[model samples]
Target: MTPRFAITDAEIATVVAEFYAVARTHPGLGPVFAAHVTDWPAHEAKITRFWKNAIQFDRSYDGNPLQVHRDATDVRAGMFDVWLGLFDSVLRRQLPPETAAAWSTLAHRIGRGLRFGLTPQNGGPPDLRGPAR
Candidate 1:
C-alpha cells in the first residue's frame, strides 16, 4: 500500500529538482554526483520516478538503489548525512509541513539503509550481495 503522506507527484518532482539543483553545486555532493550523472534532466526524471515509486508505490522506477550506490565507489558514509540534509531542506521548502515531515521520515529511513549497505562491515569492503539482477 502507498504511504499516507498526502504528497503529490508534482511536489515530489519539485523537491527532487530543487534538491539536485542545489546539491549538484554543493562542494561535497557536487563532484560525486557529477561524476556519475552526465544528463541532469534525465537523472532528475529517473530520481523523480524513484521517489514516486517510493512514496506512492507507482511502480514507475525499476533500479536497485543499493546496487547503484555500491557501484559509486566515491560515495562515502558521511555523504548520506549531507544528502539527507539537502533533501530535507528541499522537502520543507516545496511541500506542506505534514507532507514534508512524512517524506523526510521515509527519506531518512532509506538513507540509513543505503548508508549501511555502503559502509564497510568488520573493516572489510561493503558487501555487494550479488547485484540487482
Candidate 2:
C-alpha cells in the first residue's frame, strides 16, 4: 500500500520557505544560519532539494550537512532544539498531521545526527523523536 503521508515538491518548497522565514529571524537559529549561508535564495533552493531528496527519495541532493555543521561554530547540540522547534512549527502549520509526522521524523533524525556529529565530545548514537507539537 502507498504510504500514509506522501509529500510533494510543492509541499516541500512551501515548508522550506515558510520554515526559513521563521528560522532566519529566530533568536537562536537565525544567526547560525545567517553566518553560514550568504545567499538566501540559493540556500532556500538547496534546502528544498535536500528535503525533497530526503522525504521523497529522489536522490537529488549532493551537499554534506555533516561537514557543513561540523565546520560552523554556531552549530551545537543545544541549538537543535531550537531548529527542530522551528521546523516542527512550520511542518505543523503547513502540512497535514500525517504528512507533518512523516516529515518531522526525518527532520528530528537529521537534527539529532547533526548535533552528535558536530559535537566531538558526544559520540553516542542518536535517538530520533517525532517533531514537537
Candidate 3:
C-alpha cells in the first residue's frame, strides 16, 4: 500500500534509527530505555516495523503497544510528551514538512491514547508498569 505521505520505507527507517540514537542519550528517556533495551538493533527494527505499519499500512508489525508500554514500569505519564517531542524533531529533520506533520499528528494521537492508559483516571494505576490495562 502507498504511504499516506510520500515517505519511503528507507526514510522511515532512517528517522527511526536517528530518533532512537538520540533518545538513547536523552536525559529523560535514556535510563528508562536502557533498563529494557539491551539490543539496540533489534529494538529499532521492531519500532521500524511499527512505524511502517502505522504510516504505510505495511502490516509488518503485530504487537500490542499499549500492553508493552504498560509492562515497562519505568514509563511515566510525562514521558510521552518527551518521546513525542523527540520523535517530532527527528521526523522534521529526516522527512519533508508535509510528511513530518502527518506522521507527527498520528504519533501524538497514539501517544495520547497510550498516556491515557497509563494515567490514574483510566481506572488504573498512575504508572505504566502497575496494574494498568
lDDT of each residue in 1-133, candidate 3, tens digit only: 5566678889989999999999999998999999989999999999999989887889999998888888998898789999999999998998889989989888887887788888866864333222222
Model 2 per-residue lDDT tens digits across residues 1-133: 2322587889999999999899889887888888888998999999898887776657779898778777787678789888898899999999999889878888888887887877778775465434543
- TM-score for all predictions? 0.88, 0.86, 0.88
Per-residue lDDT of candidate 1, residues 32-94 (tens digit):
999999999999999999989888778899999988988899898779999999999988888
Highest-scoring model, lDDT:
3
For model 3, the stretches where C-alpha displacement exceeds 4 angstroms are 123-133
Higher-scoring candidate on TM-score, 1 or 2: 1
Clashing pairs in 2: none
lDDT of each: 0.84, 0.81, 0.86
Which stretches of candidate 1 lie above 4 Å from their native place? 122-133
Worst 10 residues of 2 by lDDT: 124-133
- Which window of 10 residues has the lowest lDDT sum in candidate 3? 124-133
